[model samples]
Target: MKVKVQSLDGGKPGKDIELSDEVFGVEPRADILHRVVTWQLEKRRGTARGARERSDVARTGKKFGRQKGGGTARHGDRRAPIFVGGGKAHGPRVRDFNPSLNKKVRMLGLRMALSSKARDGNLVVVDSLDVKEAKTKALKERLGTLGLGRTALVIDGDALSVGFALASSNLREINLMPAVGANVYDILNHDTLVLTRAAVEKLEARFNG
Candidate 1:
């Protein structure tokens, strides 16, 4: 598939760039995307800190009071639930939330995510992110002209352009990422997916090479 290349410096649209069929032409599957997203979210979950139980509490095991006719009921130890500093009756246990997914499935889901954006016309290509002025106001005007909608995810080559990065830093609706950081979740979370010319080369090479 081919996508028109644009510039962030505000100029006429440039030539079209060809996208890899294997990476940008796959049929998106809801189930596959769901699984990958689920795995990613699960990995981000923090382990629940468990509280001390009766057996875990550091208390004496000696019996409490007289077991006969002392009026009070017989008790086991200071670790019992009735005691003031006693351990909890029931508590949660620490658990690992991370889950594993097949490597092939993970890669496939990413391809489908890219393809979905391409098929939906939400994918955009840019010539470069270089700008004469790195001011936020100037960038806003140029990007607004591109019709990138409400939110966009822009991916560049190895590192982001210093000037462009500074300009777009405060724009909450615009997210920037390097080519190596591309993944399924962030790609699909945005209204538009913009790839720079250098980013396109590296992305295609990542899968083909």
Candidate 2:
């Protein structure tokens, strides 16, 4: 698949570039994408903390009162849950939230995410993100000219350009990342996906490498 490349400012139009069918031409599968997204989010969850149980607490195990009724009632050990500063009767146990997933599923989901953007015409190929001035206003005007959607995720080559990164840092609607950091969650989160020429090469090479 070939996509036209343009400058970020939309002033210069570059040559068209070819995209990989396996990467950007795939037919999206919602189920596969859901599984991968769920897996990714699940891994970010923290384990539930557990409270100390009766056995775990450091309390006197000695008999508190006589076996026979002594005035009020007979009592066993101070470690009993009813006593003050005693261990809890039932406490939640620690549980790890990490879930295992197959590697292929993750890869397929990423491809589908990229393909979804391409198929929907939400993918924009750019010559580069290099800007003379790293001013946020200038960059914003430039992006506005491009007519990118509500939210845009720009993927650069192996390393992001410092100027573009700094310029877009304050803009909540615009996200910047390197090709290595591109994933299904971030890709699908944005309304538009912008790929630089270098990013395109790296992404294609990544799957085909």
Candidate 2 lDDT over 100-171, as tens digits, reads: 989888888989999999999999999999998999999999998777999999999987899999999999
C-alpha TM-scores of all predictions? 0.92, 0.91
lDDT of 1 by residue, 95-202 (tens): 989799998999999889989999999988999999999999999999987789799999999989999999999999999999999998899899999999999899
Candidate 1 backbone collisions, by pair? none
Clashes of 1: 0
